[model samples]
Target: VNIDYLKKHADELKRVAASVLTGTVTASLLINKLQSYPRQNNLMYVLQSYGQLVKTIFICKYLLQLPLRHRINTQLNKGEQLHNLRVYLWFGGDGIIRKKQEKQQQVTARCLNLLTNIVMVWNTVYIQEILKQLQKEGYQVDEKDLEHISPAPFEHINRLGKYDFNDEIRLQENGLRALRPPVDKR
Candidate 1:
């Protein structure tokens, strides 16, 4: 985090950023070319300093803003939940990417993503149905409460056994499983 270096090379940094944004020059290619040289790269050093400054500013804002912190934490939790869901779904090969080839690995990852999306969609559909039922029963359903609800929970899902999709009805008309009746907690 050399402030002096950043200040001295501010114009150059701006120029480089503009060039990258305009597609006039590629950052990775420039970095690769720079690394090929034996000498120190001042532009690279400046970029590193700029990156540190931006990160420091973000940290400051994160510490200062309560709403920002809450939003960030919620997003982070969602990401963690998604990762947990992926780990659960990737039970095969002990959750390891066994495929050595890049294409095979890509296919495995894409398939996992597809499964995760399907689970989310399924959970979301059921959750919405349950909410609708509760509303129909004269229960107070809040928008704020809906905002907090996540489709990441997969405790009820049977991911261990093989699924027979051939006989399964598509989620078009009465295709989703029946929603369990909501118990009165009061």
Candidate 2:
């Protein structure tokens, strides 16, 4: 199986998986009925690719929510100020202090949840690749041992996406669509 093909068509593979899961068609059934190719040969790679596709969808969804979350946080902070005023009037001192602590806990929990979700998505996408690369380098790594890594999948993808050639190509294509560079530049 060609890794380049897998990388180039990752998004399409993901769409296939999603269509299968959503009952448009059964991709697994199609794979199973194939007599020419053995499942073990490329199953892991395909699964990993599908996982990455899911992660990309999640990241896109998360980005859409970001502005709304910021707005909500801003409103919450403003509400806290009003709450503070009420507490000062009613309790005469330090009433807003408890609210502040609660707010801190709430914010910390939200941040942790966001981080965990991102990590879980990333791990699903690239854990197999990481293990494969490590084994290729003669490093012993256990599946269970990878749980301690920091920065969730989206974060890692964002970092790796910076250096990804396919992404660059896509961006360049888009740039050409919007603003055609000179033919000599190509």
Candidate 3:
């Protein structure tokens, strides 16, 4: 973090930890060497930075796993989207509902839970009907693929602003198309 300190470790200071961490043994050896040198707070910016550098390197390494990272990102995004959907259904989520009062928190939390439960119940029926319809159209449907499908995007509910509460709904045609596995073209 200082002039001469950085001047000493200049090359390393410029190089990212991930590049160093690419070598498994190199990272460990460097870490051990940094540890064994001495224990001083400011003197060990190089040492302290190694932790972050190694983590960055580790993350960089995993970043190469395009499919794996994409899958994880998508699953995480799905969870976030479901939360957003719940917030849409309940108006107290001004994007910061977690910091709300205890009563509002309890009510919203309970309502979200209740909504999740209802969606779960409806999801089973929706998948079954989708499979039935797909088979009826001569496309072979697999039951296993529907195992993780949720009904979050089934937006045909009656929860618009300043309207009468009606629970009846109609299915959207394209809801489960992507979720269905490729047709057994054999």
Candidate 4:
């Protein structure tokens, strides 16, 4: 609860956090290498360790982001680590063999892979839902609306042929016209 105490500990906390981040990144890279081949039980332990490293780094970063004098939420912190560990153990570990025993085998290489897939799926669903809500609010996507958008003047100039600046101007003007809506709409 003491502001001075928190400030005094900040440097130590930052150093610990940096080391955790370094470990997490390093482990993540190694896991990526392992994932290129078939899953094995031995690899699971490595991935679990990597997952723990990632969880540790994430927690440290989360705590560091919080305001000084604010106590970290113990339950939330534990929940995040447990969730990550579960995902590591269940989806990223020897789950492949277990799934085979159940007559269904699906493979995931590492905790990072599982986490990435989850995030991607969630992001896709979230974007679709947001688009639906936007449409419901009367927002519409129009291809023709984007016609007025053009490269910056400098960009256009840079794209010109080595010895043909005039030709570039003509090309740009023609491109703009092509982007416009057709005049003879039925």
Candidate 5:
């Protein structure tokens, strides 16, 4: 990272940033224009150096900060769990998106997202109810325990398009299924 070059072009950097923030210019358009330049653009070079400096600082902090690294790993694991759920749900077509057109592909992706969100909502609701039930039963339910729970679990979900509209399925007054009793650890 060329700190001196960035300092020299500080005003230019601010002007470009202002243009981006004010919507006078778009970042993609600026990148495209910069890339098209026959010779290396001075502002572009300065921006690249600035980006490298920011990246280096982040790498240093990520290496030194244990909490930050743990948080990042936790987030990454959760994301991977969600992706796994998506893959599990994509049972149709053998987990392959066969859509050829861009619009169709986008629609497929949106539909998958909607299904994932629906499953997440269902899991969240059930988890909250379970927590309440446990608390009511004189169990020590901690917030720390709740923090480790993810809404991405799909083990109980039947993804085979099975339909059972029987009234017995809705045993609770709230129209949700009755909460299952906690199993004994022993």
Candidate 6:
């Protein structure tokens, strides 16, 4: 994240990391480490390379995860929002992602996540007003509680759409032909 420090030590760090690389390794997965005890014959090269390999492994693990630290935190925050989204999706006492096949279920879940996010963004103003009123009344709520996600509030949405996955859905103008739009949101 700090460009100045990266610029100054970039070459130095690269050199140090390179210098840590050990004995020549072949393509297949495992690396057989050869080391000798004090009583063993001359195998100094193998012994020294074993130690270097361990050190390199440790260094690479640490560096590999360093750049992902922020992304991991963001994932943690998004996880909390999933709880509320699940509650909304549980309209029929279960979410729409109850498929037996793991792959199919994953696809269903991702679609639901996107749909939920869209609904929350569309109702941003309504959600903000609620949060503002709570704050004015001296509630001790965190601003994060009013992030770009809201509970599923589609009172007019048809929860009884064809339950059978094999049935083709009727549509008109790219919208569900059998469903009714909410006459009023209030």
* Best prediction by lDDT: 5
- TM per prediction: 0.73, 0.21, 0.45, 0.20, 0.83, 0.29
Error of 4 at 81 (Å): 24
Work out candidate 4's RMSD over C-alphas: 19.0
Which regions of candidate 2 deviate over 4 angstroms?
Answer: 1-104, 134-186
Give candidates' CA RMSD values in order. Answer: 3.7, 25.0, 11.6, 19.0, 2.5, 13.3
lDDT of 1 by residue, 1-186 (tens): 778888888899889889889998898987887689788678777877898999999999999999999888887888888889988888889888999999999999999999999999988888988888889989999986775678988787787678777866545466776666657999
Q: Is candidate 1 or candidate 6 better by lDDT?
A: 1
lDDT of each: 0.85, 0.55, 0.64, 0.47, 0.89, 0.54
- What candidate 3 gets wrong by more than 4 Å, as runs, is 1-61, 92-104, 142-150, 161-186
73-143, model 2: which lDDT tens digit per residue? 66666556444433333342333233358788687556545655654554554555555656887998975
Of 1 and 2, the candidate ahead on lDDT is 1
lDDT of 5 by residue, 2-81 (tens): 78888999999999999999999999999999999999889888899999999999999999999899878888888998
For model 6, residues 1-186, the per-residue Cα lDDT tens digits are: 334544555565444445445423432221232232444432333334445666787667757897455455555656665565556656663555568999987887787778777766645545555565567879877756444343445643455576566557776553424333336868
Task: Give model 1's TM-score versus the native structure.
Answer: 0.73
- Pairs clashing within candidate 6: none
Over 28-93, each residue of candidate 4 has an lDDT whose tens digit, in order, gives: 665566576675544444445455666787778877776421334544454564455445435434
**Which should have the higher lDDT, number 5 or number 6?**
5
Q: lDDT of candidate 3?
A: 0.64
Best by TM-score: 5
Q: Whose TM-score is higher: candidate 2's or candidate 6's?
A: 6
The TM-score of candidate 5 is 0.83
**True-vs-predicted CA distance for residue 17, candidate 6, Å:** 8.8
